[model samples]
Target: MCKRVTCPNDGKPTWWGCGAHIETALAGVATADRCDCPHVPVEGNPRMFEVKKTEDQATA
Candidate 1:
């Protein structure tokens, strides 16, 4: 099953993973929080559940 999280910046569902890690991966840029929708993290990091996926949709 695939999971995703919402980037509070741009209001998009990024890949499920650590938000801080994603932020750091983006070189500590605000854009990290505003990543495009469906942003799947290729690696792991801290702050995994800072922002989470919306429960409005059902997974297959």
Candidate 2:
């Protein structure tokens, strides 16, 4: 399995790849081993999230 990591700059999830690939994908920016970094803040309440349907999905 590939290692799952979050991007340091955008806080987006990234899958495992070679060091060079990871670095290139991240644009040479360093990343943390885990999520919940300062760039991305987790909500204390789960209710804050809403499941929004896309236009196509909504129409379907």
Best by lDDT: 1
lDDT string, candidate 2, 1-60, tens digits? 234555444445554433335345445344553333232112564322212333554486
Error of 1 at 13 (Å): 1.5
**In candidate 1, which residue pairs clash?**
15-39
Which pairs of residues have clashing backbones in candidate 2?
none
Model 1 C-alpha lDDT per residue in residues 1-60, reported as the tens digit of each score:
224455654565444544545544444335545555453334354434344334444231
Candidate 2 Cα outliers beyond 4 Å, as residue runs: 19-60
Give the range where candidate 2 is weakest over 10 consecutive residues by summed lDDT. 33-42
- Candidate 1 C-alpha error for residue 20, in Å: 17
lDDT of 2 at 1: 24
TM-score of each candidate structure, all chains considered together: 0.26, 0.24
The residue ranges of model 1 lying beyond 4 angstroms of the native Cα positions read: 18-34, 37-60
* Per-prediction backbone clash count: 1, 0
